[model samples]
Target chain A: MGTINVSREYSVKEKMFLPAIIQGMIITLKRFIQGFIFHKKYTIMYPEERRNYSQRFRGMHFISVDENKVENCTACFLCETVCPAECIHIVAEERDSASNPYGVRKEKKPLSFDIEVLRCCFCGFCEEACPKDAIKLSRNYELSILSRQEGIYDLNHLKREVKGRG
Target chain B: MSSYEISKSENYLNYCSDKIRPLPVTGPDAKPLPKMTLDGQVVEFVPGDTIMQVAERAKVASRIPRYCYHPGLSIAGTCRMCTVEVEKAPKLMTACSTPATDGMVVRTRSEKVLKSRSGVVDCLLASHPLDCPVCDKAGECELQDYDYEYGPSRSSFVDEKRVFPKSSTRKLSDKIVLNMNRCVACERCVRFTDEVTKTNDLVMLNRGWKKELTVGDEDKGLYNDYQGCLSDFCPVGALTWSDFRFQKRVWFLRGNASICDRCAKGCNIEVHSEKEIIYRFVPIYNPKVNAHWICDEGRLSYKMVTNSHRVIAPLLEVAGHGPTATSWETLIPVTASLLKNSSRALLVLGTDSTMEECENLRKFFSKFVQNGEIRYFNGTGITTSSENKALDHLLRQNDKTPNTKGVESLGLKPLDVAGVNGFDTVILFRSGRAGIPSVAAAKNLILWGVWSDEEVRAQKNVRALLPGLATQEKSGTFMNCDGILQSFKKAVEHRGYGLDVTRIIEKF
Candidate 1:
């Protein structure tokens, strides 16, 4: 294929870039006047204030806890199976009989439940696949991590008190 | 070893349940078999075969569901889930107990039959604890499968369900755990212990709604080699293998065909694994080998591969220190030089090796080493195949290695009874199942194949270690104790830095 360059000579108005610069300055001046005088702001101070996201918005995952602070996850692996990004990993173990007075209802517990937030696509399928309403995606979207290892949320982190999906 | 089709073997014919066998037609006195109509399909069966058997012969056994009707166990006709509508009969007949008559028309999926099965499932579910999340047999449980297929969406019984609190999570044995609340009271385990194993270890304690499963001799406590089989055939989550209790959910696993190498029986097994990590070994229904059972030893043999101390990477000894993990690049040349320098080298092939491996090593050693003598060593009590005996009447054999007969059939001579005495360099090759031979007198020892850290550390003078694949990780044929040649595909990928014998030899 031959190249067809649509190169054209600049007109006098376009060649003189002073008008374009002045137009850009006028728009900036209008925004400055709106913000400085009228006190109209488009963005907030992110550290002090937060935006309101939809209640259904899928963010970081958390395992719901019961009245006694015991995680509701039986580690049925439904979440791990439904995860599209393959980020959810769980190890299941039998709950000790001494601590498990609830009998078959809470007989199994997750020995280790890990979610790699870096790899998670935040699809919220794990929340839907969970039978006991154990794993749910909370509205806490601040997921900054210092290291790659910090991105993996363990059972302890996942079992944090998430009051009504945060 | 002659490769024979597993389906046509005499052991398969013998192992087949006599209650549900096809009529003999080969002999001169053989006559045409009786025929029956099942769900509009005509199927041939022996005279005494049940309606379930006729449907099985026609490959439509799934049309009928029975909690108590295991092919390997005697028919109890207690579940009443296999009810089918026979045209002439006034009431629905249980397919598992009723013998098929010639020219009888049976409708397995009739509305009446469906209602009857739904009723059976509803009754069973009335007392069945909804503990599938904690149940080990959740994915493969027959009750769950039947409930999904033929059960009512909700039960009518609102009364308090029966609960045996003491027996709910009772440990029947070290190998099995019994959850009485989850049982459908199929009594398949009791029947299995009574008929198959003849151990009489388990029994139905009470009668009717309060019927419970408990060890016959509480102190004896399920003392049977085939205790794993009870969990295998249990229709519900009542009896579960303790080893695989909460290890993994069955639906997440992927199964591949393999052979158990813990004994010479060579039971065909389905290696259930996920992401190259094996979770458990369940027996594949091979009538010629392990009909429907695998011993606890073989069922739990995946630990050998997944052992934490297993040496995966190749190792080489430093100046005076013990074997240290090293790359194959540096270890191969060093091993070849050691083999070349030794005046008399002996290669001891562990009888656990497959036929192809033995052949490969025998051919490789003949051309590779100067004065190398290759010999087979089965350090598991018996040195030769002739001395190997059955530990039990069932699957367990006296020979711990899987392929002693196979290695012996290769024309390889057994090592001297005195063990490795005067060899300059001794190469011991195994696949983790074979016992280690005494090498106290050897100057330099080269350990190959699957070895744990303790095995390598126990040796006096170990020069180098070469890691190889376990039985489940590699594809090979085995000559079972019965001289049946069964070839298995690779079940799982080797989760290690181990190399194949052929590749290791090629690299050298």
Candidate 2:
């Protein structure tokens, strides 16, 4: 077969530029109009405004109990042990002997339970490991703190919210 | 001219091109190092080694103090006195726990590090009682030393100091005394007792200001044989030995490294002594052997040597009455005559006897008695059936002797009481009720033990009763259950008829 190499070359004058440039300008002009006039504003002053959360959303943790308002935590230490980051520290003491169902006394109760929010990864492991369904990540997400020490949520803070919810 | 010029030009250009290209250099291995400087001294450390360990290895002139970071224990990283500044890290990091990395700059003496360290020291002091005057661990206490070196002048805490109700000063056992007020909650003693002794007797109780170290339920005292370790492991004056408490300050005693004769575990120990008297025995760190712990049985074994009930002089048998105190010169010949005349003389030895004494007795018996037989007996019974399997598993046999393995290693068989009918004469090496079997069967007995048990002392057939050196009175080796040979030095001289068995056997 006789090879026929098609080679075409033209000076700058052969290329059409006006229509392509016009098409690009039209697209840009349309975006500018949308940005200035048609687009809705998304910005809000964060401190003054708040965001809505779903009913099932997991946020700052809170301990909840049954209808009887009894503390659901047995202080089994399963949640503390399962936490990948050792941010949860639980110091348990024995519950009142008369309150236990087994008639046998225990050696532990949560005397001081603290969760370092700064160190927590919020993976929901604590909630998953709680057999008693005591500790839960609630829908309240306002968890910012000004100081490192303030981020360490103590037992008093946990029990207060837990009592309110219960 | 044109041909020569073209050829030269081509060759020169080729050489120039090759010369300009980067060539790899072959040399000796490059010494890998970090770009950090510590206390103005350039040093190199392997990546991931802590700054404290690196500074220590480099011999840097910096004091990165620590309390919870013992070289022998797992780093608790509680005491933050070793804080040092890193060039890039936001806050100063504790030198004892922080890992060193390549190109990471460290400054231990920088103003920031000093300020942070002083702040930690001040906070630690805020809760501390600062009762160094009467504290037993005052001179040697790590807190006292650090306070003198880097502590702030005073604390600003104006609140009434948190006071824990002093738990009834309880004796955990015969060897240990627990003083709760002096505790700093370092948790070293609890960790040592739990991890090393494997005895879960002591644990941390409560939380925050109410935290204290306590044993199990109120009635169940610390009954473990390793209870004395709490005293040795306590960095503060919290746990003290009943024997050594209030006797003398730790600074007054000079420590000499020695080995324990209690068992075959060959626990290395430090004999703290003053005025030629042993105060206490503390376990020294030996990775292959006992790691910073020893049995309470070993710690209290020093009492036997210092007791007034020891034998001080040699004795010989009188005709009608019991054995009379005689000179060493006369006793040896008299004993030799008795052994030489007897046809079926038997030598009975206590398992507590040292290897040197056993060997010497074996040699002396061979020469002194014409046709005598030698037998071994351990002085204590071994009760092994228990749920505490760790302690039971440590018991080698029913004999609670320290050197039974050593005697067995010497090819001498232990005497079975059931097999022996009777013998003409039997010799006792050490005192214990366990040696009564041989004493009862013998027609005539020669006792050379330190403590006088009623059975052996009252036996009418007993011929000559001589006092011999106890384990603590002599320097000798003992083979423990694990077949590890440990040597103990003479803790003190015998008060009564105590003489080294090696020397006693030499007389015969």
Candidate 3:
């Protein structure tokens, strides 16, 4: 069977495309002039410029710490239980009484706290469920990882100092 | 009373309230007991039952809150949590200590009773640290539950809570940690040691506001076999099991009913686990078996399955270097060939094995070995079920194996130590609780069932290893020391490449 070409002929306005090209150029030039001269930029220079997020924005997770720098987490498992994505895994252990001066307040501590950022839905349930106000989400959304293992933030990683919501 | 006598006694009581006591279904010939009006519902009760017991028999005991009214311990009406409004009585009477009379009327949740409970809770909370975030007993603490149900939302007293400075994190013993600030002064632990264990290891020191719990013998320090029971019945986080202290929160644990296989007493237990990892074993109330308490050894027996050294995969002895971890595909054929080629094989089943496993192994080995003899071994010193005896006054048995009586009931003979020499190859099967028999005479040894790395390494003549599931990972029936048949379902999934006995036999 022969191939059928359903081609239609162009009108004068379509055949003469200089006006259309100039119209597109004019819009580009308007944006360029606005960005360069007026400094009204629409896109950010990402590595240097960042978008301002609200205080409640949920991103990477972290464990809160006290003035002594010891984690405030009592390892109550409330966050693990409330996590909708089931990404949080924790192992709790008693703080050595010899080293722990806070007595009953800092008695129990997390032996291992892991959060699979890849699996986490960033729902902020963990932050809400945490009784000790330990687990929290920061506004630092730079979560790109080179490997799968990097996505799993461990106790040491989560214990990293985060100033407020960062 | 000794644990044996406690188990045999018809009037065995539990730490729980009588509300859990199921009333006997009345038959035509059954004697009619006196009736009492409990919460406007007419309920029959035994002649000597207290108001609390009557409520329990009526299955409405939950309506009454309790602090020091454990069925296993003597009544101490100090907390005043179980007070009820009696129709004729001008004052609210304590249900635990007050006996029920014929045609007596009681209101368990009257406004007066609720006000009384709220008062008691308020007093308890006045001294309570309320550090539930770090308390191990947070989810199961009666103080927390009662406070939620009947306590006043706000407190009247604004004074700083009483703190037992030194005793706040005192080590009562290696098994228990005492946080004095969390104690509600229920004195249940004191009563438990005094009445039940009878060791009198713990005592309430001082009077009123300054009251504190201290070990009777400070140097000896809570040296009772049943110390774990103290933590089990403790209504608050005052007494917490150290093994489970910070392991996991109680709310995250999922409990499944299983029997403690550490001893022949076979105390019924609830295996508390999360994600197939056991956290602890708490005794389930079985009046005829273990009544609301298990020994510390049994409670901590879950470590055998969770031990890091436990061999989980098939191991094969290569180049006389010893057993090395290998896959089932390669190990199964080697195990089958070894069994098939052996001239005279001896299958020594550890008495810790369930009756089903013992019988299954016997049948499977008989088919696999042309000239084979199947025998049971209890290497915890006892050779026969008749030789087994109670080690303690409580539930601990001298016979460490859980099913020596069970294996015997299956018509299997005990392993003759001298007879182990005649066999060319010996297959030693156990579930980690049974002691290893002296089978050094056997030239070729095939280790099967839960074996730790150290246990596997000790054997010089071992050929291949077949790792198997522990008691918590499998379902089976065990005939306890008393010849009582108790069956348990798998408490957790086997976190290993180990196959069931039937599955292993099928591969053979």
- Report iRMS values in order: 1.2, 16.8, 0.9
| Per-residue lDDT of candidate 3, residues B1-508 (tens digit) | 1222112121333334444444655788777788989888999887777898787756777788888988777789888899999998989999988988999999988898899889899999998888888888989999999999999989989999898889989998989999888887888899888877888999989988998899999989988888888888889999988898888888878988788899999998889998899989888778677767899888888999999999999999998567888998899899888888889999989999988898789889877789999888888878998988887676888998899988988898888748688898999999998888777788899999999999988888899999899998898888888877887888889999987887888887
Better of 2 and 3 by TM-score: 3
For candidate 3, give the lDDT of residue B503: 85
Q: Estimate each model's TM-score.
A: 0.93, 0.62, 0.89
Give Cα distance to truth, residue B353, candidate 1, Å.
1.0
Each candidate: what lDDT?
Answer: 0.87, 0.65, 0.86
What local lDDT does model 1 show for residue A75?
A: 85
Identify the runs in model 1 with alpha carbons over 4 angstroms from their true place: A1-29, A44-53, A145-147, B4-22, B25-30
Candidate with maximal lDDT: 1
Q: What is the descending lDDT order?
A: 1, 3, 2
Which model scores highest in DockQ? 3
| Fraction of the true interface contacts (Cα pairs closer than 8 Å across chains) found in each model | 0.71, 0.00, 0.83
- What is residue B362's positional error in candidate 3, in angstroms? 2.1
B1-508 per-residue lDDT for model 2 (tens digits): 0100001121221111121122333468645555457776777775556777677666552367776665545567776777888888999888877877776788888988777877877777676656453345666777777777777887878776554445424466666766566676778766665655556678889987788888855676676777676666576767777777545556657776665655445466677776657778877655445654677777876665555444467666678756667888888787778888887888877767777888888888887788888877754553211111234322213344566676777877666745345577887676332344435666777887665544445777777777776655567776756566666676555556556766777677
Weakest lDDT window of 10 consecutive positions for candidate 2 chain B: B1-10
